[model samples]
Target: MFCNQCEQTAKGIGCEKVGVCGKNEGVASLQDLLTHALQGLAIVAVAARKVGIVDPAVDHFTAEATFACLTNVDFDPARFETWIRKTVELRDSLRARAEGAGATISNDTPALSYRPAADLAGLEAQGVALNFIPSLDENEDLRSLKQITLYGLRGLAAYTDHAAILGQESDEVYAFLQQALADLTRNDLGLDELVALVLKCGEVNLKAMELLDAGNTGTYGHPVPTPVPLGHKAGKAILVSGHDLRDLQLLLEQTKDKGIFVYTHGEMLPCHAYPELKKHPHFYGHYGTAWQNQQKEFAEFPGAILFTTNCIQKPRESYQDNVFTTGLVGWPGLTHIGEDKDFTPVIERALALPGFPNDEDKGEVLTGFARNTVLGVADKVIEGVKSGAIKHFFLVGGCDGAKPGRNYYTEFVEQVPQDCIVLTLACGKFRFFDKKLGDIGGIPRLLDVGQCNDAYSAIQIAVALAGAFDCGVNDLPLSLILSWYEQKAVIILLTLLHLGIKDIRLGPTLPAFITPNVLNVLVDNFAIKPISATPQEDLQAILA
Candidate 1:
């Protein structure tokens, strides 16, 4: 099984024998099978949609199936097998419905008539056909564009699923996702059509993010300036990680009055900004740093670690038993909470383990500087810029990884002049979050906007800044320093590109799957840059 659909693929190349994310050969192969089946299902769903037979369930399932194949999301082969079967079942049902509705679908497409192997060996026998590496299209450029579009859809699906949990639904986004997936399996579309579709993925991603933002802000209220305690409190505790706010809310509700203190970890750190979740007394401070540091951090923490969504690593033996997964996240040997949302297993584990003996002084980190919060203080920010209190703006944010060069972000943020405001989101901020950058004119120098999805907020903030200054977004004294990990970051970058945002710096390294020609297109159109080895020089280049 070969996979390179993430920032931290093996040696900056595809992962072959085993996933760098700890998905063994079996799980990785299963994910390939799942993705292949989903593409077939897309063929059926897209055909069915052509006949005005819109199946929301089929659309939603495709998104979910794609998400499960994302890096670090799921590593359970059995679960992936289940999803493959489910996707095939849906594909068959949709095909029948389309035929009954007199939809004209060519039976010639291999994707339309895909049959899953009943067993692992059978799955392996049908190997190369199931892999994404072997594209149906012969043109290398078109293949690269198709992959970019497909990965974008996978990222959009994760966002869509999260919003759906909050009762927010967008039919347009779902339809486009289904139609695009089917298009990937089509042999007829040329490079021009594929490139246009890839750009459209960015547009649809913006909509999906908007839906998620509304769901989050509407449910939790716009995140106000809130101080999140970094240290733990004395008591039975549990550390919640990943990006699922709904699961965090349910856990908060279940842990209420139970004496088990709950803490946000990793991407869930922003949950504190939401007033609804923070209002709970048992909901205490944030624990540890980013997802990459989980093994060490989880062991150090005496409480159980609960993963709500992706970015889970292979657990260490010390804390392996203490970890629990829920809501589309899975890892072998770890206890999983089903749809019941009953976090009893996790809560019991927390109770059995010794929590922090006493609250330690780990300092405070600020989050919740989402779009609304920034917009609320728009005038003051505008004044700060006008008065010269704010010199430049650096948006340093993205996924965090164990890769060595990632320290460039930490160094860059550290070197930004005190007068410059640093805007960060997602887990990449973990490197310097504990460092107090101080505030400039009452605005924190280091501002964590929100999770990766909250890049929506940074984009909003950038657009607003441009509007106030009466110039294009690129004309502002702002720099976007992004560190991508998975497909979500891919889609977000595409969105930035779609908005015509230029001179963006991407690192620790560019995606392995992006060929030289594709990179040329990106560099030519968007002027995208690879991060320089020297952070100081990079900073000088940006400030120049």
Candidate 2:
């Protein structure tokens, strides 16, 4: 199995045997097969759409299928097998309809004609040949650019899927996703065409994120400044992780009077800020820190656990039986909730377990400082800047990983001066989120901007600050120190690049797919820089 689609890829090259994230060879190969199958579906979807035949089901399925293949998202080969067959069936259905309308799809394309392996062995054989590294385009630059585009689409699918489930759908986003996927197989495309597609992916992913933000804020009112308890509450408690607000809401609704307490974990920590969701008394407290620490965190948690999306680690035996997965997330033996959204299985396990025997009150941290919350106080922020009270603004946010170097973020945040405000989003904030970074006057030094998708909120805040100051964003005292763990981070980075954001610091390690030439292109064009070895050095460099 050859895979290196994440920041934690083995030695920053490729995971040739077992995935560093604990994905076995079988699971890795199946993910590759699933990725290949989605490419096929995209070819069919793009062709059919041209003849005025747009299947929202096909578009939805394509987005969801691609999402299922994201890093650390789905690891069940059995699930991949089922999804692979479904993809082929969807592609064929679309192809036949298009053919009836005289839009001929040739069987000559290998991607469209792929048959699912009858069993796991056959799946491996099919996938072994479909490894992504081989350059179909002789030009190395074009090939690297193609891969970068595909990675962004994978991220786009994740956001699109979330928005879709919440009853928010964008045909334009879906169309661009399909077309982008199909471009991977197009050998006729030139370098300029591929680069444009990558940027367009950024443009559309921004739209997809906007749709999700709207769906989230519209369904559950815009997040307000609310203090979330970091302590564990007494009673039967369940920890809901990942970034799905809809799942958390449904679980909270069902568990409402059942005496079950639902605590947010990882990316779900920000859910506490929503007025509609937080109104529930049982929706209490946040458990654990970021996604990378889940192995230890999930085990220590007394109650059941529910994963609503990506960044799921292989469950430890101690807590394996107590864990459940829903949405696009999956693991081998975990209980999975379907579209019915009935979490009775998860609820039953929570009740049957021995929850926190004694209340452990750790402390509290304030979140939900989303765009609306920040923009409402734009005048104050503008004043803080003008008066020289808030010296600098650091956006230290993204997904966290298990590597030891991840300590850089914690140490870096530890070193940030008290006068500087820190804006954070996603799970990366877990590094120093609990630390009491004192406020400058009434404004808290550390600001939580909802989930990773809420990077949209962070961007809005930055743009708003620049607008109020009557200067470009770069002219403002702002710096972005981002850490990426999965595909969603990839698209977010691309979106920043597309917007011409410069001099951002990205670490724990760069993507392996980015060859030296590609890295040079980024450095030359975007002025992107890697984090220094010492947090002190990196922090000093950023503030300098």
Which pairs clash in model 1? none
For all predicted structures, in order, the TM-scores are 0.97, 0.97
Mark the regions of model 1 whose C-alpha exceeds 4 Å error after superposition.
Answer: 127-129
Report model 2's TM-score to 2 decimal places. Answer: 0.97
**Residue 20 miss distance in model 2 (angstroms):** 0.9
Question: How badly does each model clash, as a count of residue pairs?
Answer: 0, 0
**Per-residue lDDT of candidate 2, residues 1-544 (tens digit):** 7777889888888889899888888887777777778888888888888898999889888899889878888888888888888999998898999878778787766888888878878987777777655634677788788878888888999999999988889899999988888778888888678777878898998899999999999999999999988887778989998889999989988998998889988888899999889999898899888887888888888899999999899999989999999998999988999989999999999999989876777889999999999888887888898898999999999989887688899998899988799999998998989988888878899999979999999888888888888888888899999999888999999999888889999999888888788888889888998888988897777677
TM-score for candidate 1, residues paired by index: 0.97
